[model samples]
Target: MKNKSIQIQEKHHKDLQKLSESLGQSYGKLVEKMILYFKRTGIDPDDLKNESPSHKIQQLDKRLVSFLKVQERDILKPLRQETYEYYQNYDKTLKDAKANINKNLGLLDNNSEIRANHILKELAKQRKALITLSEHLDPANKKGLKTVFQNIFKNAN
Candidate 1:
């Protein structure tokens, strides 16, 4: 490559030098990285000169929203399905427990009360799990839902 030189204002040169040091890169590498970033983002640095900060922030927000929508469709959709399946399984287990308890209620054996109490406890636990799953599925609790779903899926595997 041929050697090239360009002159910039003293203040701009100092700013670039500081950025390079902070980024642990040489000034030439920093300039190249900036050029690559601009190209990858399809952004013209010159055009930014005429754009207001609010305009830039709006653009960033739009991009983030688009990314989140895609994530919801891809990641969150499967998580939601898994959560619903878990809830359904719990409901079926609760129903089975109740049916068993009813069928065994006629026994006068000492173990009958013990078995009834155990079933009651199991029912309570299942109810609590259902409530928690419902809360995580609520539309108003997206942030909490994401965290809960992540933990659920993480532990499942």
Candidate 2:
């Protein structure tokens, strides 16, 4: 490839550098991507002749939104779905654990100490599993699940 250099104002250069870092791309790659985007959008470089800073920022924001939507569709949505399924499984496991503990409590008269120890052990295991699953969940789901587990533990005690 042929090398070319263009002089930009220091402020604009700094802004470009920041943009490159934010996008996790090298300066050259970022510029190439931007050029490709303009081409794909049928935007002529010359048409930006009188673009103000705010206008430029608005354009960048539009591109950012588009990028985020694509990311959500291509990546985040599937991951969230998987996480939701895992969360459901964990919730079912928690319910099963609670049911077993309750059944053991019902047999407390026959082997009270042994059954009590077993219930405590099962609760601890469930709590640990909940914590681990919560860590893997997205923020909103994590908060809800954590709250549920907290309530369950509080009630158990």
Candidate 3:
């Protein structure tokens, strides 16, 4: 005669298990051990790992990622790129600006007054975006986020 058993793992988060090698089994088998233990005993498997606020911090850290993404059309990216390229182009005006202001500058054709105005406008908008991003990365907000991330990425090493 033989008996059949039903395995039901409840109140478990699966990833919270901790074990070492030399247990003579793969990760799947370790998970099975957790499942078996939970099923046999009325214990929650998730009570093992550190489910710290680190998860929330990881989510919050990506908030500034979009700011970093800013494309060519992006106000900050274009402005910065245009400003850098403007001075990089070899020309008298840029050379003079570099000498006088100690910073290289680029000069567009005077004939394309409309294009010049558009470029200047875009540069201004980019400056605004940079300012906004800077403010957001201020110490106050960073401190709050740091507290949350301490669990995940603290300087332990």
lDDT by residue for model 3 (53-135), tens:
67757767776565567543578777988888876775767677668764323344465788888998996686566555655
lDDT, model 3:
0.60
- Per-model TM-score, in order, reads 0.35, 0.33, 0.23
| lDDT score, candidate 2, position 44 | 75
lDDT of 2 by residue, 11-130 (tens): 989999999889999888888999898778777777857576699899999999999999999999999999999999999999999999999878768577878899989979989888
For each candidate, the alpha-carbon lDDT, in order, equals 0.83, 0.86, 0.60
**Candidate order by decreasing TM-score:** 1, 2, 3
**Decreasing lDDT order of the candidates:** 2, 1, 3
Which consecutive 10 residues in model 2 have the weakest lDDT in total? 134-143
Which one wins on lDDT? 2
Q: Which residue segments of model 1 deviate by more than 4 Å?
A: 1-50, 107-157
**Ten contiguous residues minimizing lDDT sum, candidate 1:** 145-154
Q: Judging by lDDT, tell me the better candidate of 1 and 2.
A: 2
What does candidate 1's lDDT look like per residue over 1-157, in tens digits? 7667789999999999899989999888888899898788777777846576689899999999999999999999999999999999999999999989888775568788799999989966875676578675775765676457657656755
